[model samples]
Target chain A: MKDEAMALRDTHVTLAHGGGGQAMRDLIDEVFAAVFQPPGMEDQARLAPGALAEAGARLALTTDAFVVTPLEFPGGDIGKLAVCGTVNDLAVGGARPLWLSAAFIIEEGTEVALLRRLVATMAEEARAAGVRIVTGDTKVVGRGAADGVFITTTGVGVIPAGREVSTGQVRPGDVVIVNGVLGDHGACILAARGDLMLSTDLVSDCAALGHLMEAVLAAAPGVRAARDATRGGIAAVLNEIAGVAGVGIEIDEAAVPLRDEVRGVCEILGLDPLYLANEGRLVLFVPEDEAGAALAAMRTLPEGAGAVVIGRAVAAHPGQVRMRTLFGGSRIVDMLVGEQLPRIC
Target chain B: MKDEAMALRDTHVTLAHGGGGQAMRDLIDEVFAAVFQPPGMEDQARLAPGALAEAGARLALTTDAFVVTPLEFPGGDIGKLAVCGTVNDLAVGGARPLWLSAAFIIEEGTEVALLRRLVATMAEEARAAGVRIVTGDTKVVGRGAADGVFITTTGVGVIPAGREVSTGQVRPGDVVIVNGVLGDHGACILAARGDLMLSTDLVSDCAALGHLMEAVLAAAPGVRAARDATRGGIAAVLNEIAGVAGVGIEIDEAAVPLRDEVRGVCEILGLDPLYLANEGRLVLFVPEDEAGAALAAMRTLPEGAGAVVIGRAVAAHPGQVRMRTLFGGSRIVDMLVGEQLPRIC
Candidate 1:
């Protein structure tokens, strides 16, 4: 039964798939139900109580909606992004990702073949993240009412006992480290859109980072906080951390990691890579004494091979972030005043 | 802080609100963060691990997406539907609804005031259902890229100790009971659209059924199975139960509870009340011996004032649903074949 459902695909979807009828049931049975294969046939998925007792002392919940245009992109599609986006959010909050629920809002004329491909990717990613896609819902809108498809994934995880991670824990003399090169996702999506009329071999850095995060936590138990540099890039993350912790952040512009192609695209577009979004990158804060070990641990993973110490926390200029320029000058890095990019995620 | 942020409203939403920038943060603080007020500033909401210990031995998780048009209708809006839709799914599965995560996809140019009104309504409905909106995500797309707004809500709940429910447990001679009048929600949305050129003061029967479901479970703990009549209506639910349990169901048309206005609308439009979607209705399969007490308990609640025995489970014609008409004729009530309604919830 398991392998039999793997090669199946449907060409196009109709409004009936979301009508809560036999057509919908057939669609689910053939596509999602076969893949998920939950324990029972209840409308809701059941998780045994105390299931997380060994993993953590608390539950972490988060959700994200994926509406990235060009559903399929250079390196990954919306499916991989949806899974990794929610999983990364939980991981950055010091949670061991466990279960997820997916809901889809699909246009009536969307090809079922596309949905199958996306679901397959989701299943593969869920397996990589060691989580289950347990429950889901589907709704279909008219042809003109929606884009091709929109996916919203919600995740549940367990926070380890006695391990509290928050921006409030950030203090002076804390080093800031990022997992990998910045802006790969944002840059890749822009180039894929073909609006810039520029071509680059850039691929999105969309991936599940739970395993890498776990490795970092194991080596740097004293890590203060971590955040996925997603929508607003590392600049937004630093500003938010500074604002919430009532501290200031200083980053060396030359020390920040960036791909030459990404740098080129940003330069041509007159956009700052500092504010470009990322899908598989994160910013970590650790006390000065523990920073070395954290960076070493992160560097061991392929996902974090480009890890580097880009900044540090300070008590001066409370609630502010500043960047040291490559020209040996400094300037304030303010929270984005308006939208520099939209639908980049 | 609780009440200080309510007065601000932007004339319209822009790309910045979803850009993960100051504009997005301010909007979240004013609209959602104020209402939810989750503890600590973290990427995910943290919940005590033992919180569900007293409630039951398992957790029930479900998700639903709401794309109902017109945003607002006579009795309820899309916000109310989003909360109630997911909550009722858990409730019908015999779980006490607990926490919810809401994700919103908004089209640029939507009125911020409209979004605020919807968010306020959602908070109110969540409070009424004894659930908290703990985590969320928001995304904005270019104008004409999406409908006005779409919401997908995922819920987590706890099943009570020693309570077990499944369609597999249904048996012959078991009576079926519904909590309230049918099709009000479906009828209301259609009229609200103004496309039918018909309006008769009918409002949607959109309400959280958790409280009412609790009463039913307490009265009939031995109930075989239960299902909420939402997307495909009671007809779809009945057909599913019949097919799953490998049993036949027979319903008396005269016994089904319905409102005159809804019936009039259906009659005028050549629609069957049984096939119209509902928001707060449920069908319970109770043993013949306990059916009377169950119906009585349901009728005591305001949400279930129209409670009545509509049918009985039978062994004949296994895996089929047969309906006895008011004209003394019987016909197979098969699953919905095509899209009768789209974006109804």
Candidate 2:
């Protein structure tokens, strides 16, 4: 069995590998099943976690599809991003992510070595996030019908009894805090694409935030809500909170953290850093009395070492978000209107 | 809000609709959220079904990616297939599907009307299958980077207490039963492609089997296992059961059910019906004593009106499947070797 498993001679994926025949079985056993180590070959994974049996605990589910260009990039690849993206989606909802299902659509003629690297990275990320890759499926499309590969990951988690986190939970006088530098991921992808003739030392801030979230919840049980600043960055998140909570948000422009490299990229590209995407950063809302505890808890983790107060929710001007400019003027920060960076995730 | 919701003026999808801004929100609200009616706008869906709290109950997870060409087909489109495929995966494992997460990878310039139709069909199918589409994501890639659209659905289900179904549970005396005529889906897809220049009245046998499976389980509590005969058809499923259970499966060629139209298409294309796909067919293994009850239960449902016994497990030639020819000769029915019908699902 070991010899046959190691004897996959195909250099590139083919239509036959997705035909539900011997070739597909060989590819799955040698590549994905080898790395993921699922519990069985059944069509579905059976899970009986203790968390689900707890009284009043709710199940949380989320999904994301990754279609980034230049499949591989500095700091992380599509595989790492897929895992972290879904994990953070659950974590921000106050759920403890437990299992994930990964489905891949691979174009014919994709290199098998590249797939192996992606699978390995996914396994590593799943391990770091303490989640299991329980079930998955693969499909192959004809050349030109699809890019090299697109991955969709679905995550399952358990929200503890009596725990609730939502955008609508934000209230007046709640302090807004963010973890780490913003726009590093967006700046890194722009430089990685190499289309604009730019170079930078910045890498994607794509890290799973489940552990950091758990730490914060433990330290400040009164945290109102949390949202990962992903596709539309912090600007989108703040606007969503304001609309959903029916409150006004005011942010101090200087208090928003930004790395020098990211700032330089935004300036050179004539872009606003506020709308650039980030993978690991999150905006958290807590009551004024617990804001210090939340910030202290976040700063204890390396991923959140730059945690700081970026803004606060106010009763005036409900359903609006405004930024207090460094030059002493304030302007409304509206939701993104159009595409600033495509496929940044 | 009502007028704004109906004012999706864009005829075709563009990068802006996936830019995590107002456009994306409008698209989601008008096209998806309006139909699926997810409970909240949070990153994840919070579910507290009573089934999860039951003692000994287990959660089931499965995922599948659909990339069939000609997005629309005679009997169903990719959207219906996505929902049915994931639901059947959970159903065949003795689980009652409850929720699904759908993620789409769409090419820029695809018609918005096409997307609306697909989402509507998905909503209809989910309603029929008794499952909720709780969360979803959409990404738009540059033109030519992807086909019309690819859907990946992840399903969550629950297994009742003490219910166990596995390929390894098929005993030597188990009887193999099929729910309906085989190969209709594969044959229909071939004719629908338009490249073959063949026309047929046959339609893809695509339907959700959750209710049928529940009925069967209720009728025959001792059934060993069940498998949806999808991509590589009954041939692949039989071979897998034989290998996993360490038992030989013997079938009578004349007893296997088939439609004349499907048989004609297979004959013209020099394809074997045994290796053709069926979206709504399943192979079940039940104890000889309970086969009658199981078949009778299946026959009560329209999806399984043609249920019949096609084969039986035996101790001889363990780990292999064989067919009895009409001329009194027998031959081994090995697993499929290569692609017969690509993207037939």
Candidate 3:
């Protein structure tokens, strides 16, 4: 906090910081450049040729925009969400996340101290994700023109040789698994809002899963597909896989893992745990023979300590998902039709 | 517009379009994916390994955000600005532009027809730039939470081996040159707003300069520096180069190119043409002996037909910029102190 105060004497963002002059340069130099330490000037980042030539693989590119309300959350902030979101996108595509670019859209009158904290959080998160923020941009709008701040992150990574993970690879007998408990992120955000008149000792499960994903891929080379359960949660991921592969997914409700606090919150709010978002969790499908090894490898990592086999793919009811409830009844799970929680990240 | 109407029954954006479900998929398929024709699904875009391996050089990454007012102008729209902006950043850094990732933050209640036009414009501009729109993300915020729309674009390109362009290469004897007329973009946007009750036939100078930059580099391999005159215009670029190289720059005001329409707007509005924004213009520095060759090469391209030698670097008055007036007077040209035109891109 003291570091932020000394960085910028102004209490709020001003028009000059986005004027593309000395003020803008000072803001970038003091905040972004101080953290990124890019090789050359702040305009464009030039990477070493030798470093890339040795990777020797095609690059995977992905992008996401984060505009979650209440910039700061229980366990993490928008900065962590931006880094982990882009990194996980690359990781799920069978790529090793390497570089990222962050662009900020800030509203005038937003506290400069808040921006400093956010940039610091982003730098820390980038280091944790094993990626460098190569280049970035900042723009400021009038008070009503935008919310406090919105971040758009883009990432690049190298796909290892002969690695192909797609829904097309799924088979009828493929086994489905999840890395950890679901709905922690969404539930935590809801509680943080302080509108539900509820309280719980829940923290967001936001984390960068590149390392854990690498471990799983190493153990289960035959993994058919992998996707993070983000916005529409595990239910949305299953439906997507089913629709693309033209297969049926059957989940055992008893085997799906969830924290008691998350389940309680969902029940009170009339929301289903399956449709809530998760940041640190991923749904993976592999051949039946490789599921055990994949789960064992995932369990070794703290982020995936709750890894479990939740379901299997089938030929019946093609392009559909069905859950066998704990009461021994089956029900269809379809794609969410409308917004549930806006800007929950 | 007719296609947009047929695609979305209601013309305005809805919360469901950003829900990460069927609605989002349909929107992407009908608008973005249909135009981009990305290699794979919207989750991630994978580049062919063989293609990248052949490039055999380091990569350059850059990102920029566009919140320009008046989405549509005489010569270009926000889409063109977003694409050309990032592409120029890479080209100025001596990188062969390749791929781009675009992210959009749309306000709810905005017309889908407007979005379709913007996306189409982006696709066309990307084609002209010889780049691919590989990956993208979209988010929608409630009305009043955001302005109409904002775009953030990130670009990746490979820097050819042995190509070096930086302000550090600048020397006291280097010559300065500009590609074309200045202040056209800023003037055009100002007139487009209609709030000033001003009318003119002027159009924006927005364009992707990858090919033109490549031609200049081929003709003048020993060029010391290059930068697009965007916000803060040529004055900011000169001040930056002076500060970074610890030298002085002296400009001949009579030699600087400017359109009559742009000059008239600046004079009537009490604005300095040197501080107005430009889209397609660039400031390049080279050795005095090679200045003629660079000018000849630039004139070969339509975008640089107005290229001229405008200034020279000096060892005295280090880190300063002074311009010789048409009346034989000289004055310091320091960095822009405060806002001139907001959201000028």
Best by lDDT: 2
Candidate 2 vs candidate 3: the lDDT winner is 2
User: Per-residue lDDT of B1-345 in model 2, one digit per residue for the tens?
Assistant: 113644578999999888888888888888878888998989789998569679899999999999987799999999999999999999999999999999999899999999999999999999999999999999988899999999999999999999998899998989999999999999999999999999899899999999999989999999899999999999999998898889999998989999999989988989999999999999999999999999999999999899999989999999889999878899888887679988876
Task: Choose 1 or 2, whichever is better by DockQ.
Answer: 2
Q: What tens digits encode model 1's per-residue C-alpha lDDT throughout B1-345?
A: 112453345689989889988788877878788887766678799997554655456788999989998899988899999999999999988888989999999999999889889999999999999999998989999887889999999999888777887888899899999988899999998898999999678888899999988888888888889898988899999988987898999999999988899999999999888889999888899999888888888888899888889999999998889999999999988887666788899
Q: What is the CAPRI rating of model 1's predicted complex?
A: medium
Interface RMSD of each: 2.5, 1.6, 3.6
Ranking by DockQ: 2, 1, 3
Summing lDDT over every window of 10 consecutive residues in candidate 1 chain B, give the lowest-scoring window. Answer: B1-10
**Against the hidden reference, what TM-scores do the models get?**
0.96, 0.98, 0.96
DockQ of each: 0.65, 0.75, 0.56
Q: Any idea what lDDT model 1 has?
A: 0.88
Most TM-score-accurate candidate:
2
Per-residue CA lDDT of model 3 for A37-58, tens digit only, reads 8777738988753333545466
